[model samples]
Target: MMESMVIFHRCRSLAATDAFYIQQLGLTLWHTQPGCHIYDSGYGYLGFVEAADFELPAYSCISFNCTDCAEVDRLYEKFKGMKGITAPRRHPQFAVYSFFIQDPDGYTVEFQKIVKEGEQ
Candidate 1:
């Protein structure tokens, strides 16, 4: 089988960034170097490196899917004291409960849980 990974181009604080994702977001560090690192996201991998000129784009770029609203809620509470977090909201049109969080470098990560039929 073919293999691939997701890598964020640049980062400011490698330790801080790694801690947030690994400790707070539950992603695990899989590899590391002086200015680069990769995370094990269970299903795949995520990586980042130091870059002085790095600037996050203005958009919701990536998302993590949870089993349900309760799971998303649990994560929200755990991360509420952290940096960037948008309160959870439900969208009937999309049948989803979700929120947004920004990394230390300003990159946005979305958390979502799908509402099964009749729940919407």
Candidate 2:
């Protein structure tokens, strides 16, 4: 049985990635440094690392469920200039409002708030 959870992203710049997830997405920071940062995203722990340790995968996106979709967009807009976050919009498949942004390491991070259930 899986007792705990962890998601790690191999990034090119840990500091930038940390800031985007922490500052932009408003995720609580568990640990922070130049090459690594651990964040508590209310659902699980997310770790961002910058090292020649893991092979970079094809462009992947991670969806985070939030309480408020509006706030998600607000924070994303705030960090858009500082962190170079791209504008995010609604996700058609999930019937949820989704904000898409690129992390410092160029990983697509989607902040999604499901508005309704059983959306196609």
Q: Root-mean-square deviation of each candidate, in angstroms?
A: 2.1, 3.7
Off by over 4 Å in 2: 31-35, 53-56, 80-88, 117-120
Per TM-score, the best of the predicted structures is 1
Model 1 bad stretches (over 4 Å): 116-120
* Candidate 1 lDDT score relative to the true structure: 0.81
> What lDDT tens digits, residue by residue, belong to model 2 across residues 21-108?
7776778888777678889977789987787655567868787776777767775766566443556667656577866666666567
Over 1-120, each residue of candidate 1 has an lDDT whose tens digit, in order, gives 878767565788788788778887889899888899889888778888988787776554568889888888888987786567889999657888998888888888888988888863
TM-score of every candidate: 0.83, 0.69
Model 1 RMSD in angstroms: 2.1
Clashing pairs in 1: none
lDDT computed for candidate 2: 0.71
